[model samples]
Structure formats: structure tokens, C-alpha cells
Target: MNNDEIKAALTSKSRSAKLERRGKIISFLCIALIVIAVFAIFAFVAVRGIATFVGTKVTLWNFLSKTAWAPGTTDASGVPKLGALPMITGSFGVTLLSALLATPFAIGAAVYMTEISPKWGEKILQPVIDLLVGIPSVVYGFIGLSVVVPFIRNTFGGTGFGILAGTFVLFVMILPTVTSMTISALKAVPRRYREASLALGATRWQTIYKVVLRSATPGILTGIVFGMARAFGEALAVQMVIGNAALMPKNLISPASTLTSVLTSGIGNTVMGSLENNALWTLALLLLLMSLAFNLLVRWIGNKGAMK
Candidate 1:
């Protein structure tokens, strides 16, 4: 090659190498920042959570076993009781029930959107669902209070501010997340899979039910996990309807408090350095742990699905 051509080629190579190095540095910096942020949050929460026990001398077993969570009240000995079993069960019950109620509707809506009505889904339904996601939690709470609470009270004959009210509110709140994610997952399934199934004499319904859904199972599960996480972490909307009673959930209609509700209601009222305050920190720590566990479970399920 001529000298000019050689110089041109060398300059281009130099520029490309610099660009590549810059991209790698940017990517590494982004990843490092994320790792540091996660570790920092965990450490901060952990120290505070442990301080509740270390500073107050309250046994972890007592925190777990006691059913009453009367942080404001004390017994004859003047020591506050900080049992969390009731709140723990309440959180689990509402989260699980909401997930159960939301999952089927989410999956069915996703299927219809992706497979049955793609045109209308793209033009109308998707935008509406997206709008639902942007609506504030407090708005949901207000709606539940005005509409769902009265309906439940009139129909079921309880106070209506209970687990059932919370469940209904959460069901609506989580629907958009689960439905949108599931639709994306279903859409990700290759068109050729459906074509092949139909070519093999499988009916349309059979192909969607067996071939498409099976292939999208992992993604659908990931969406469900996400929805459940949102449900678990929700505080304001649920707190508005659930009566915020720190008691074990007796039935669907019973007034109960989840961990988030208890934290939101009690944290502002407790004095710092008190056992009550520290116990609330412990509850925060438990919530963080639950979120981490759900994340790990999602990763595992995703990996397993990818392997299959």
C-alpha cells in the first residue's frame, strides 16, 4: 500500500481502539457504581437493624415470636412489647392473596393482547395499561376507600377496612406490571414456534396454550415475581384500606397490618434509640432481606428457564 493509505489505515485503527477502550471504561464504571451502591445500602440498613437489638438488648426470638406489636404501650414492668408475628403474617397473607388473584387475569390479558388482539392491543389497550402504571398509589388508595371499602362493608358485613380491601387495591396496582411484562414475554416468543405448531395440525388455541405459554413461562414467572414484590413493598395504598391493625390475619375480611403498613404508621411516632424504634429498623431490614430473596429467586428462575 502507499504511505498515505497506510497512514490513513493506522489513524483509523488508533481511533477505533480509543473508542473501544472508552466504551469498556464507561461500562466498568457503571457496573462498579451499581455494586457500590447496593453494598452501601445493605450495610446502612444492616447496621441500623442490628443496632435495634444490640442497643436495646431485645432478643431476636422475642421479636419473631410475640404476636402483639404494641410499640406505644408497655406492660406492668414498663417494657414495651415488640412482637412482629402478626405483622409478618399479615404481609405474607395480603401479598400472596393479591398475587393469586392478579396472576390469572394478568396472564390472560397478556395472552389476549399479544396473540389474540395485537392491533387493538397496540393501539388502545397498551396505552391504557401504561397509563395505569403512572397513576399514583394514593389515587388507588382513594379509589379503594371510596368504592371498594363501601362495597365490601355492604356485602361482607365487616368494617370493610381489612385484608380484603387491601387485597383488592393491590390487585389493581399490580395488574399493570404483571400484564405489561407478560405481554412483552409472550411477544418475545418466536413466531416460528406458532407457525410450526399450526403446521403440525395443532389448533390456534392449542398452539397458544401449549407452545407459546410454555415457552414464555419463565418470563411470565418473572413478571409475577415483580408484581408480588410491588405488592409486598406497597405501603400507602394498602395502609389506607387495611385498617393498620397490628394483628394476625384471621380471615380475608379481618383487619390486619403488613410490615410496610406498620413501619409507615409506627416509625414516625417512635422515638429514636427506643426499643420500638429499633424494632422498626429490624422490620426494615427484614423487608430488605425479602426483596433480596425475591431478586435471587427471579434470577434463579430466569436461569433455569433459559437452560430449558
Candidate 2:
């Protein structure tokens, strides 16, 4: 080809390449913008809720670890305590209860579904468990109210709505999530490993107990963490079964409110500036921090596993 013809073709190709790069850059920016927008909405809502409760200014020590938790007062020394310690304890208690209830069954279900189930178990039982995931939390609460509370009240007597009832409801609520995540995580482990273990004379149960479960530990823990987060946030269903009292529960059968239920029921009351209200926001910020920490930890752990 003549030099002029070659130059003309090269210019045309360069222009097309430039346009393609620009298109990709634009697409990437659009996706990033969408992600940022979503995070922004959550951030904005959380901040607004805090401001409505915490007021404009904040102190260093009080902001960090004050446990008093009463809201409202014009004075800086008015003692707008967050009562974060007890609330955190309660949240952890409930989460622990749910997590303990969930782990064994979820792991078993996942193991059976992937490692032990027959063809019919895989096809039929898997679908049923999957279906259970679609059930609403409120329905679970209703069931808890009708059968669980009555059982508790009848067996245990008065103060029927208590931590145990709420815990039971939470246990049921968190199960589907735990089981589904566990199943998916276990399934994600390499099939080749299982086969190799069998070739090496490892029994099916041993191969799973030793290799598959070990590899999927991080993923399974992630599911448990998610369950904890969900249980921490659960209010309506818990409130229905947990008595509305603010006092610390003496017994599993005694009535008491969770941190979530307290925040919900407290805000609308006339005690807007009460220590309780301010404490609620403080507890909220702590919860937000907790959730963020869990997500970050999950990411870090997942990345660490991937690196290995």
C-alpha cells in the first residue's frame, strides 16, 4: 500500500480504539457512581437519625464509652448517656443464642445436602429448605406468639413474653439464612478434593469432616455473622413476643425489650430529650459501627483465604 493509504488506515484504527476506551471508562464510572449512591443513602439516613437524637455537638469521652444512656437536657453535664454497654451485651446475648441454635443444624443441612443426601434428598429436601427461606419474619413471630408464647406461659407461667420466646423466634428466623449460606459455601469447595480423599481411602464422612468443612469455614462463619446482624436488628417480631418492659430480664420467661425494640418504642414518646433517647442514638451509632466492622472483617477474612 502507498504511505498515504497506510497513514489513513492507522488514524482510523486509533480513533476507534480511543472511543472504545472512553466507553469503558464511562461504564466503570457509572457503576462506581451507583455503588457510592447506595452507600450514601445508608450513611445519610444513619447520620440523620443520630443527629435527631444526639444533638449537634459531641464530647470525646462521652462519645466513646459513656454507659449512662439517658437523653435530653440543655446542659453539657445533663448526662445524655448512651447505655451502650448493656445494650451491646443484650445484642450479643441474643445474637449468641441465635448463632448457637443455627450453627449445628445449618452445617448438618449443608453437609447432608452436598455430601450425604440421596438423589431424592438433593432434589426434594433441598427445594423444601429453599422454600422455607422465603417465609416472612412476621409470620415466624405470629407462630411464636400463638404456640411458643403459650407453651412458655403455660409451662413457665406469667411474663410469657420474655427473652426465651424472643430467642426462639430469632432462632427460627435465622435458620434459613444460616442453612442457605452454609449449603452454598460447602458446595463451593472443590469437588476434586472430595474425589481425591476417596481415592486415598478416606471415607465420605471423614473427607467431609476433614477437608470440605475446613475449607468452607470462612464462608460458613460469614453466614453466622450475617445471622447475628439480622438478629441484632430484629424488632417487630421480637417485640411481639418479648414483653415491652425496659427493665433487665430476670428470667428467660420474664418480659423485657431488646435494644431495637427499645429504640423503636422510645423515640415517639414525650421523653424525646430524655437520657433514654440520646442513649438510643448512641447505641445506634455503635450498631452502625458494629455492622461496618463485621462487613470489613468478612472482606478481610475472605481476602486472606483467597490469598492462601
Q: Candidate 2, which segments miss by more than 4 Å at Cα?
A: 1-9, 13-26, 38-82, 269-279
Which candidate ranks first by lDDT, i.e. highest? Answer: 1
Candidate 1, position 135, lDDT: 98
RMSD of each: 3.3, 4.0
lDDT against the true structure, per candidate, is 0.89, 0.75
Please write out the lDDT profile of model 2 over residues 1-308, one tens digit for every residue.
Answer: 99999998877757678899999999999999999997986676466446644444456455444444445544456544443444454566667887898889888877887888746557866777767678887798899899899999999898578888888889888888888888888888998989999999999889999999999988898888888888988878887888766555577777776778776777677465544455566556666777787788778868876886
lDDT of 1 at 34: 100
Query: Residue 55 error for model 2, in Å?
Result: 8.0
Q: What TM-score, computed on C-alpha atoms, does each candidate reach?
A: 0.90, 0.79
Candidate 1: give the clashing pairs: none
